[model samples]
Target chain A: MTRITSMKPVGERAIRIGFEERISEETNRYIAALCKAIEEQVHPAVTEWVPAYASLTVYYKPETSGFDEMKSFLESCVKDVHDLEGEGGRVIGIPVLYGGEGGPDLSELASHHGMDEEEVIRLHSEGDYLVYMLGFNPGFPYLGGLSDKLHTPRRDNPRQNVPAGSVGIAGEQTGIYPLASPGGWQLIGRTPARLFDPEQPDAFLLRAGDRLRFRPVDEKEYDDLCSRVENGEQIVEVEEGEHAH
Target chain B: MSFTVEKPGLLTTVQDRGRQGYQQFGLSPAGAMDEYALQMANVLVGNERNEAVLEVTMMGPVLKAEKDMVIAFAGGNLQPAIDDEEVATWKSYHVRGGSKISFGRPVNGARLYLSVRGGIEIPEVMGSRSTYLKAGLGGFEGRELRKGDRIEVGEGAGSSEVHAGRRVASEHIPSYEKEITVRAVPGPQEDYFEKEALEQFFSEVFEVSHQSDRMGYRLQGEEPLKHKNGADILSDATAFGSVQVPGDGQPIILMADRQTTGGYTKIATVIGVDLWKVAQLPPGGKIRFKKTDVHEAQRLWQEQEDILVQVASYGRS
Candidate 1:
């Protein structure tokens, strides 16, 4: 019962919606139970929703709601998202460091998959991924499982500077670049964990149904957690969703 | 009271009427690219209609005043002036105190705003004092407005009284055309184009491309669009007048500091009351797209928010 196939109108103050077009986790658990049933009844001219990789968008406020009153307030924030369960997300962790100079394509993507650079950093620091959307910059993310024997494609000559937290991968996806622009993925590692920080009070260190893992670390614990995340220290930990109240 | 710079033009910064709900963490709601000329230049300088202003861009800054203040300028018409006289945008003045105020060529639009009377004292970050200059974050220091900077102000209607000129109603100003059309609302994809490339994207025209900025605007038509089996998608969200279309089919648009998710194939959007004619177009101008649907684009976006509440009741009397 997590259907949503169409909803359209991404303007005159946003809509999108769509689901069931691909990228599993059962369509990101019905886009995280319709973003937790529209963040539990939000909709006073909505104003923010986003999710992605199977769609959600939302955003409202056309002088306080229009478009059939926000399409029946998002069709009454949909209800049977497979009997909505959600209380899961909040893993976090992060660390990294992988190869030299921010993983210069980690020994050529571990010899293009013959596996070596420490078995491509133990299959990209093994599992627990799933981010499915943040964006092409500012806090980046768009991650999805990967590990199809460490798939790798996007680099037909790309990087014109890839720095800011690196990580990469491309084809069967895997991300992390949160802002040093110009990319084409495949890098392999580098993550001091600031992941977008407009002087943080939670300025994004990952969010679209967050849950990430990764660990590794070694350039002296990535230069001591990059000087304690450049001294506004939050040094990556997260965990918290105990029934995410 | 303040203002100093001395010609830092071709891209001044600080904006407002943006930073809304954090674009779901990928943060790119970087404010005012002409939000009805930033609420009519912050209600003709009586400030606080989302205050902060100064946009400029396409050569304009020259500042000076540093104390007497109380200005206003509004969008698209970089020909403002003072030390040499000629000043006329949506009006509201009162300068003095070693004045100067300047600006000059490009008499049309490509952003202008300005406003003043006690506002740009900069601080708000996530709650926005606008300016996301590709993530340096908030205004005045999140970058731009350089060469001897200075600025400051925000105290309370620029130390009480004296800014009385008001103008606005030239039929509430909004004509900066070099051939514009805008309207858009087409789709969350428009079935990924190619119905004659979505009828040549509403009968072609395009243009505007000096590699544009404030996050987008790279159009340039000589007929490219085609898609239907390529132009990739999966990446989503992207709004401020989206349009996208990549895979070299050329379309871009997405402004007001873009990037809140995207992977191409947008096909249409521009319709927050015609996004100030695509934020006052201008590189090579031209543009086109007409379409209109989200129930008449939210009733012309709530009739352009009741024409900004009748332009704030004509700046109060």
Candidate 2:
């Protein structure tokens, strides 16, 4: 059973339950599982549940449930949740165009790591990143399992606008920019796939607990994929992963 | 049943209580910043409390009523006038077809809520009409009110007799003050900050910085509060009214359009009942935090809910 280190009121309407202070796939899985269990055990007062790296915040209607009532409900629910298993989600394949104007910091990142640009691309594409959570921006996934060799700190001066689909790394984590926003990550490549689209039937291109793999594509392929996306085509491939944990 | 936007003001959008049940997927619950006022405005117009209303920020929009309608203005005194004739706020007004309703200088507060007899008839996205500007979803075309944008209203009772001259009591309506005191409960991460910093945070009067927006209010004043260890904390879910202190030590109070999660340490969370006070504070407004326990916060919320429930009885008897 996962030990819940603390449970406290975050404002009058919400209660934050912290499982651990550290971030790990196991702890994140527990967070996700606990989130699932809480949703399954629906309390009318609980309006929303937001799961993060190692904690889950439960937003409730204060008029319906007070702080103590919600806290007790969460405590009992957490006690019932035992497994840290994550239900294996879809594995999404992302096609990337690496080392060009799309990836402004690629050459700098390669040299900083004492590796060539090609090696950087190869290592980055091979690593299977697990989507821990989606936050920061709409549909922006916080992925784990980046190769430690490629770990680079965020830029001192963040770029004013990193284009959407710009794959970047910050500290030990890697993610893609879903929208054109100011960011401090070191850009390494650009993906042709649209990660966030309100117009799409599914809306968001990714979900938490999904596995993501990057495959390198040339300039022509990138343009073709972009056009396909604009034409409202689902070019990105999704396959079944191994099994639910 | 409809109105044409003659001149869209600073930032006007449709909002209800909020977008709920989708925060887990990283969706911020974009809604009316001053929900109490939104509810009161709806109550005055005989619409549901969660009905979508026009949320005017900073400035006011110039709209031409396409049809005779009963509308109520609440929250923020924008000095609303019809055809240049001044109209008192917190009361229902009847506007004839082709009559122009314009808001002059903002005499008080930062946001104004306008509710017609019926709610704004916009397509609901994810169970809400509230606009989340960052994602371009919900509200009218998922954006702010602009010139020539025509909005349709629902069939609100279809009564020819307008409930004009109906007003909420002066005590019921919150007066927007240049200086406000917001009550807060110690946060889930209150232990993350040093004791001295916590004392300094409560004692100091903070000014709302110009950088403040719907997302958050960045306060500026006093020395930056120091964390017990460092500012960096494990990324966690954030709530509206969460007061997060970043590396610079300034507290940023998260609001209706805040991101789902953040990594900064949140020392405290403003109570939900008092968030309207925070929402109405214009830029350069002064604020001081008074620490309160969760029970007291819950009591305040219950009290507000009771008053709203009582207001729902208007026009019924």
Candidate 3:
């Protein structure tokens, strides 16, 4: 059983439940399982659940529920839940065109580690990552499991506008800019796959507990994929079942 | 049937209670900053309390009624005038088709709620009509009101007659004060602060900085709230009234348009019942916080809900 380290009130209307402080696939799986259990439990007061690296925030209607009522419910849930459903989510393949104008920081990043650009691309593409959560921006996944070698500090002065689909790394994590936003991450590549479409009910391309892997593509493949996405095609590869190492 | 935007003011957008159940997807629940006012406006118009209403900010919009309709403008005395004759707030009026509703200098609060007989007929993106500007999601055309834009009215009871005379009782109307006291529940992360910092936070009189927006209110005080150490905390979910203290030691009250999560150490969350007071606070407004009793907060919420339940009766009696 995953121990719920602490359960505290965010306000009168919400409860935040914390797990192990470390970020790992094991803790993430337990959080995902707990989230699933809570959703299935279906308390009418439960309005939303936000699962992050090591915590899950439950937003409830204060008019219908109080912190004590919700806290006990979470406490009982933590005891009853045992299944760790992590590595088995849908694994999405994102195609990236690395090392160019699209990747403004590739050369700098490569030299920071005293490695060549090609090695950086190879290692980044080979990473089998987990989507710990999506929170910074709509559908922007907080991806984990980046090769430690590729770890780079965020830019001192962030770009005013990092175009959408720009894949970047900051410290221990790698993420993609789902929307055109001002970000501090070191940009290394760009993807053409659309991650967010507010018009669609299945708006987010990723969710907590999903597995993700990157594959390198040449300029021509990138162009072809970009056009297909613009034409409203789902171009990224998706596979069901446990992710392959 | 519709309202034409003759002149879009500083910021005007459609909002309901909020976009719920999508925060995990990184979607912020952008809604009316002043929930009490939004509910009051909707109630006065005989619309469901959560129906989409216009949130008019610092400046006010000039709207022309496309048809004879019952409309109510509540909260903030923004100097609203109809057909060049000023109209009192918190009361519904039967506006003629050609009548123009305009506003001049903001005399009181920062935001005003405008509700027509039928709610704004905007498609719900993620089960809400509230505008989340950063994402260009929800509301009219996924943006703020612009000049020459036409807005359609949604379906409702179709009785605009009785509501025309509806008015919120004077007692129920909240005064927009220059200095406001907001009650708060301690926090999800109050332990992250030093004991003196927590005490200092409640004692200080903070002024709302001009940099404040729908996302957050940056409050400046005589002394910064001291932290245990550096102010970085693990990024986590943020509530509407979360008072987050950053490395600068200043507290930023997370507002309606705040991001889903934040990385600063939050010391407290303003109670839901008192959120409207902060919402109405204009830049340069003064604010003080008090640690509230949980039971008292619940009682206050129930009190407000009780008044809301009798909203229609206020119009009759």
Q: Show where candidate 2 strays beyond 4 Å.
A: A83-86, A241-245, B157-159, B315-317
In model 3, state the lDDT of residue B291: 93
Model 2, TM vs. native: 0.96
Candidate 1 per-residue C-alpha lDDT over B84-133 given as tens digits, one digit per residue, 9 for 90 to 100:
78788888787777789888887787788888877888788878788888
Per-model TM-score on C-alpha atoms: 0.37, 0.96, 0.96
Model 1, range A19-43, lDDT digits (tens) per residue?
8777777677678777778877876
lDDT of 3 at B271: 89
Best prediction by lDDT: 2
Backbone clashes in model 1? 2
lDDT of 2 by residue, B37-146 (tens): 99999888877788999999988999998888889899999989888898988988888889999998899999989998868988888789999998888999989999
lDDT of 1 at A24: 73
Model 1 scores what on Cα lDDT? 0.81
Q: How well is each residue in A88-153 modelled by candidate 3, as lDDT tens digits? A: 788899999997988999999999999999999999999999898888788989888999999999
| DockQ for each numbered candidate | 0.31, 0.75, 0.69
lDDT (10s digit) by residue, model 3, range B1-317: 89999999999999998999889989899999999999999888888889899999978999998888888999888989999899988988888888899998888888999998779887888889999899998999889999999999876424547788777878988888989999998877788788998898887899999999999999998888887777877688899899999988999999999989877888998988889899999999999999985567767877888788777555444
State the lDDT at B278 in candidate 3: 92
